[model samples]
Target: GLLPAMALLARTLALLAMTLAITAIKVVPLDMARDSFDDQYRGCSPAMMAVLPALHNFEFQVNPLFTQTWVKAEAEWRKRGSPVSPLASPAQAVALMAYTTKDIYKDFNAAVRVAGHSRQEYRNNFHFKTLHFLLTKQCHHVFRGVHDVRFQARRGQKVRFGQFTSTSLSKEVAQKYGTDTIFEVQTCHGVDIQAFSFYLSNQEVLIPPYETFKAVLETNDIGVALFLNLVLFFVHSLDHLGFPKLLPLSPHWKVSSVSPGLNVIVHSSGSFTIL
Candidate 1:
């Protein structure tokens, strides 16, 4: 018995060690995590970066548990007549737009323009024109007049079209035409594109009209529905077993009908004393 107990304890310790190891592997070092966040925030749109402090505060408000903490904190703060507002500032509105619209502009260059015919034919045909026109329209709409879009494309960047082969003539080409365009024609096949435009859209862009929020709320609804169903099932099971009716019965009575040789006694507080 002692040996078995020792083995069980060893197995539990091994499991705990394994769990801790896995957790440690998943957890990023604090400095590295902060640095990564800082990089992302820096890479974000200028409008978004302007109200970084407000965005940080707004993030806390969106969280239900965090909002509760904020409310309690505010209540305590207000006791000294120093009330704090939970609303995002006017500058944060622009930040919110930038934050939400970034997804639309993500991976702009990686977008593959599939053609029905050969590459040359596709370029010559109206299909290329139509595609370019659409892209130009989107660029104009999203960026407005902002033209300082800069991106660093590597020499051998892998994309859907194929590997991006860099050329020395990229600067000359950018100068010949204009950097106002979304992509600069670096070579016959490969193009150099702005990286900032790839991940930043217009300030006018708001989240897709509550569809995303609806999906998130629906997830919570599913969990609540399942929990309620489980509670109802348990309640139904107890009711089906005639637990409520049995509670009112006298303590001296024997419940021979439900189970043979079984004695059920009801206490003064509607509790069962089964023997």
Candidate 2:
């Protein structure tokens, strides 16, 4: 009898240890969980990660196709011995794209559709049309001082074809733009960079921008932590009730082994039946 009693006691202790272990295992650390969430949210592809830095750098350079008109104009400016303002860099282009209203792109495309015939004409038309839109938007802060740079254009000539000279923006000109607008332009630049990288390396997977990914991670962290804590609470409650060790008694009996030669008899009915 003494041997059986000791064996039962050892089995109860083992069951309690197992419950504790389960609870411990499910208790995820906040930082580790957040990191995991971020990785999943971003769809952290090795390929994308490898190329992200280079892509960001590329954003600071002008796209050849987009800036071809500006290039042509800059060459003439150089020939005239005037200081040439650089074409909108890639980051500036994307920032303009992001900040510009959708109607401008739509109208430009429509105009190109109507008047564009040859490939060269289509390319030139797009560049010229985009140049007009950029000028009209007056996104000087997005382009920095590039907008203030004046060019000498003949009557009816597009601004890109003129001899240009770089100039600094006056305080009055700078005061016209708000800090928030500049911040928005910068934010859009970052979004475009993320979009470009996603398209280049992860076309199949939909990866969100970094800011969106962070927001999703923060939201998921709270939910995951709550769920894990709830589970831990349930397990602790079960352990307190002596679950898997103590059971209800009934006429219909079920036997479980607590230890070798130690049996726990439980009944489905509301009665305690211990053997």
Candidate 3:
């Protein structure tokens, strides 16, 4: 935990240094995290943008590097008037930075999980909503027609990815992650970030969080569908077991007599119809 925290702090300090160099500012205190944002990232309303900086000094602290990347990317994105690069948008870069910072991402995910649906009901919700928008938008278009390459590994197991995933079109890269005991990832999503990525070759593709996923891939949809499916599954499984059912169940929640299973079919509308 200390190592990760120290790493994030180092990155944050690097970003702050970069900002200071660019602006030629004499002093920028850590408390002024909100002021660290460049004026260029105006894609979101002041209110929405406010949420990010507020995170720095509050209960949830984020890396300043992320905010800087977002600002720079957003400025470039707006100047181009369209998303030319996959990770050009501020939101997209921010998403990547957050994912890179393991601790922050984990904590953010936990908070979002706790908030659940009530978080969405708040029209003013910015932090989680912004991240949701960023990840979902970029993921939807990643790895369009690329054939899934077989890893040397076995059939079913987990493969861990670092902050910036290093992948390649070459099978050798895949083989590095594969093992005799571990199952190869048959289906995965990746994007060529050579244009935007630093010090990376064109042959390397960055594997995002949704790489192993086949369906309900978008982060937003997955979270909602998974939660709903679990709740419904738990209720129906109990009903089948002849246990006392919980009250305040949604009328729209169609209860089944089937045993607990996670066979959820997510529609394009982000609604899951479990069977």
Which is the leading candidate under lDDT?
A: 3
lDDT of 1 by residue, 74-172 (tens): 443445354222322333222222222333222211222222123232222211121121121011111111022222222332211121112222233
Q: Which stretches of candidate 1 lie over 4 Å from their true place?
A: 1-5, 8-25, 29-72, 80-275
Local accuracy by lDDT, each model = 0.25, 0.27, 0.33
Error of 3 at 136 (Å): 2.7
Model 2: residue 216 alpha-carbon error in angstroms? 32
What TM value does model 3 have? 0.30
Better of 2 and 3 by TM-score: 3
Residue-level lDDT tens digits of model 3 in 195-267: 4333233244554332232222111211101110000000000111121233323554433221121122333
RMSD of 2: 36.5
Q: Which candidate is the best by TM-score?
A: 3
Flag clash pairs in model 2: 249-271
Q: Residue-wise lDDT of candidate 2 within 1-275, one digit each (tens)?
A: 99999999999999998666444432212221111101111132332333333333332243443344344444443454543134234433332333232323334333433322333333233333333222211212111121212212122211110111111123333223321111111111111222222122211111111112011111121111111100000000001112144443444755543222112453444222223
